[model samples]
Target: MSLPEVRLQIAAVTLAEELSFTRAAERLNITQPGLSKQIAELESRIGFAVFVRDQKRVELTEAGHVFVRGCKDALALLEKAVRTGRATQEEIQPLVTIGHSPYVDPVLVSALLGVHLPLYANLRLRVESMFAQDLVHSVLSAEVDMAIIEEPADSPLLTLVPLVTEPLYVLLSTDHSAAHLASVSFEDFGKVGWMMFPKRANPTLYEKVMEAGKRAGAVPVEVHHYVTPHEVIQLISENFGVAIMFKGIAQQLERNDLVARPLTAAGLQVNIRLVLRADQSSRLVNEFGRAFLKRVIPQGQQAEISGQLLLKL
Candidate 1:
């Protein structure tokens, strides 16, 4: 049986990063048994053990290290060939499917789309919206070409580019008793009903909010769960609860009766990023990523933004 080139490279890269079959399979959104079988097939084709496994842990063998390194370079070159082929096909216009979380500001996304669409007139583009949990999964499974996500993924096999970081704010009904406060601290959060994204949808952000609240002297709070910013805003307007929102969304959600109190606490921010599998990198993906970041920084301020080193990681 012939080994598929892409699958072998991916299996090697993912297993190398995780050093555990189960963990790598989870990241790749595949079953552990399935991943193990693929690795076994790859090993058979190469006539070597890629990983030495025990009851508790998995480690790379000497041959595994060499295979992983060679595959990385080989995969990169293969990606280059595909990108070059796509760019040269005059009759073929590649459609780039970009996935985004429900929390991403629609207005900002629309604006960025306007900037990107004109530049890539030859290439088609599609945007998909999903919950954070699903968005990350879609990226790993290649269900979408790329995604704009708030979750900070440290997976070594993925390429994550930080696009923007906006201050978090408290959204409340103007009539709410605490609405009059000039600025809100995490301590003040326990006073109001707290609206949160489902823990699975955005675990990192949820945990961060909870931890900040705990440090700020807040106790057991009335919490509500919602899927979209619209739902959270509607709940706030109805006085059901207040929510932590990134300042970027303020423009998309227009409301005079609802107010946003900036979180004055230092280090309180929402990070937005462009994420994709590192092995799937392409010229178009890089172009779109940089275009989105440039749009965020503004036209004449490109030099200023560059000097400040805004886009990181």
Candidate 2:
């Protein structure tokens, strides 16, 4: 038999993931019969049944297990190759793709570009706004050179560098009754509805916010799930719901409709981290990472100092 076809191998792996021939066909954007024929041909060439057929569910056979694993590895490599090719031909200069979490302070981007422009004048920066989990996946898959995520990733394949830790705050409408308070405990907002991101988009941050509410005996009265931090602020401004976010998010607001109060309660801090693939050794990524660290660390220190001065007053 000739060498196994790449498309056939890919089809086999996709089928293994979906289990149902119809579902697998949808995922691969092919008809069910076409997908079935590809898988059958692959099995024939490899001389082993790839999937065990059943009336209700399709199960992977032993040969299927090994073939699927290999196919996935091949697909990953192909993805990396395509990304690299695009970077080389389309990018006029060295390109660094940086994935950012929703809470990443927008002002930091200017500071980052300012610092790096002097040294790497021709460097191109591409910013991808995504959730922390997706950012981690982008870095791991070589889709992005690096990322600025909410916290250190727990995965062994990524290396995380601590950048800055910012305090979390409760964002209230300026016209709200409790807005004048110096700081509002979670209990103070117990009866208030909250604007929150969806659990799937930001599981870690959502869980952290909920845990704080639980500790204060304050259940989230209502949650307006949104995809971005800006959307959450908009909902708060519209009086739809209040929100809990890091201090820097306050900078994104233009209207006097919102006021940010420190969440003086303990354990409400968020750490911004720089994450990259463990094996990556890109000069452009390293430069951007350094610029990001230099900008955030100083701002964090200044914020700390200002907070202390307020206490002294």
Prediction 2 TM-score vs. true: 0.67
RMSD of each: 6.2, 10.1
Off by over 4 Å in 1: 1-17, 20-91, 116-120, 279-281, 298-313
lDDT by residue for model 2 (1-313), tens? 6557767776787788889998776544345676888888888888888899877889998878887998888978876785677546434577777778767766665555555645566777777888776676577667787777775435545666666677777788888777889888877774768876577555656677888778878876677776666776667766676777767776455367788887766676777766777666555565566566656666545444333211110
Clashing pairs in 2: none
> Each model's C-alpha lDDT?
0.71, 0.69
Compute each candidate's TM-score over C-alphas: 0.67, 0.67
Question: Which TM-score value belongs to model 1?
Answer: 0.67
- Top lDDT prediction, candidate number: 1
lDDT of 1 by residue, 2-36 (tens): 55456666877888988888788766545577688
